[model samples]
Target: MTTTVETIRKGRKFDQVLEGARQVFMADGFEGASVDDIARAANVSKATLYSYFPDKRFLFMEVATTECQRQSRDALDSIDMEAEPREVLLQTGQHFLRFITSKFGQQIFRICVAESDRFPELGQKFYSSGPAVFRAEMAAYFEQAEARGQLHIEDRILAVDQFGELCKADVWPRLMFGMTKVVTTAEIDRVVEGAVETFMARYGV
Candidate 1:
């Protein structure tokens, strides 16, 4: 049976294995990480680790996905979909900016980029578990806004992507390439406000 993140969260053994896998993968890249190290670190037998995750790659995928889900849930928890568009977008954008610049986020992102060529599927897994999920959620928010006549979006998917790009402007590109590590809260606010303004200008009915 495919292990869900919820199952891993609820099961102490599964959580142990996931924590061990995360630590090992962080210390040693995916290719260099060994199951023996994970089993030992987790204090579980090989059978226990294998029961939760069938292979190293699968374990990495599940761990990364679970982390992404946790971050997304935490960041987006305060967003009130029923709130004013400007407030909602501002809150969401700031949360996103903070998340991507966080230490854990940066580490996971670098790992995905560094190992992408060797483990192409890992990159795909990261995208599916992270950006794609966020985009879909944003699209749903746009659909709700349209229903309330707050926005007139002819193409919600495109709007979602466009808004995200706007929100990340001057932040993600610089941070991702290591041009600068400190994206001040003020800078994030400026970017998010500008994006919200532009988005509302185009979509607000």
Candidate 2:
């Protein structure tokens, strides 16, 4: 009986437990979210919860990974990848900023950071699933755009990273540092537009 991530996902109550954990984690964060509370939230006994996830860290990682995959899929799907570079970057920037400034996004980041010292793997897993995967997807798009003569990116990886940072500029930091609690649509648009402009200034053909 190998109770790995794959096996855990196959459990009948996997989604239920994941949802319950996500709710609790969002509310209380990793350090504060107790197993007892998670089980109660899922309407399952502690034993049942453990049966699906032997460790709390595993559960948290699963929640973060699953959410990241879903977010990436949804965001990419909504964007017209075949559009002009400016339009594509604009849409991608908007989606990126919107998510990173979101409550769930912030929570996921905080959990990874807060638990990093004790469990380095937590941060690693989050980065791999979230940022790393995202960067790769962006790079693939940039390469295609370059081939189409829509952009001229000598270093796709660096360009992708820069674009991400540009999107984060003010909104992401303010939210992360408690400088602002709310981000209006105007703010998202402003930042995303700036990101696209800067990115295109360097890469647009």
Candidate 3:
């Protein structure tokens, strides 16, 4: 595929707009953030912003998608595909926990949950970009492990759900409330160890 300069410039502008929209949404949320705010943050006129994004909802969704894709790519990139199943799972878990506890992740979760009722489509978009994507990717990894005789899981869906449940116990409470307590590296290591042990016990070679 030929890559044009105009296309590259447009891509850069889209990234800038998405980053600006993310800041606006995190600071002011859905209802509070206006097109003017996003345009000002992006150093573009309202007309230019509207030309890129039809409305605030669309802009917010785009920002959420961008964040989700970036995090997912980062997580996948950090893992060594040639590693053992257990090692890959542990590394992926640690990366996921770190990502979720970051500032941007917290803001994205807050915005999605807060505006879910008012903007049902946004909620769907958030789910599709975030958890759903993660689950699907994890399932693919599990499938590969099973093919290699590292795991005995027959059902990918069940394996994904089990992994999600394992992570949720540590992630949900902290995410749902301002429980000032931070998850330390030692604690994350413990969680990963326990989760992996249980998972392997259930489906190990």
For residue 179, model 3's alpha carbon misses the true position, in angstroms, by 2.2
Tell me how many residue pairs clash in candidate 3.
Answer: 0
Which candidate number maximizes lDDT?
2
What digit string (tens of lDDT, one per residue) describes model 2 on residues 83-167?
A: 8898988888888888878777777788778777766777787788777887898899999999999999889999999999999
**Which pairs clash (backbone N, Cα, C closer than 3 Å) in model 1?**
none
- lDDT of each structure? 0.79, 0.85, 0.73
- Clashing residue pairs in candidate 3 are none
Off by over 4 Å in 2: 1-10, 23-37, 54-57
lDDT of 1 by residue, 1-205 (tens): 6533334333568788889988887677566789999999889999889877765766876677777887677756778878878888889888887777766567667767776766666678778877788788888988988889899988889998888889889888888888997889899889999999999999988
Error of 3 at 132 (Å): 2.9
Q: Show the lowest summed lDDT stretch of 10 residues, model 1.
A: 2-11
Give the deviation of candidate 2 from the true structure as CA RMSD.
3.3
Candidates in descending lDDT order: 2, 1, 3
Q: For model 1, what is the alpha-carbon lDDT of residue 110?
A: 75
Candidate 3 residue-wise lDDT, 39-149, digit = tens: 889888787776676656567666877778777888778788767888988887777777666655665667667767765666676677777887888888888888888
Give per-residue lDDT, candidate 3, residue 62: 68
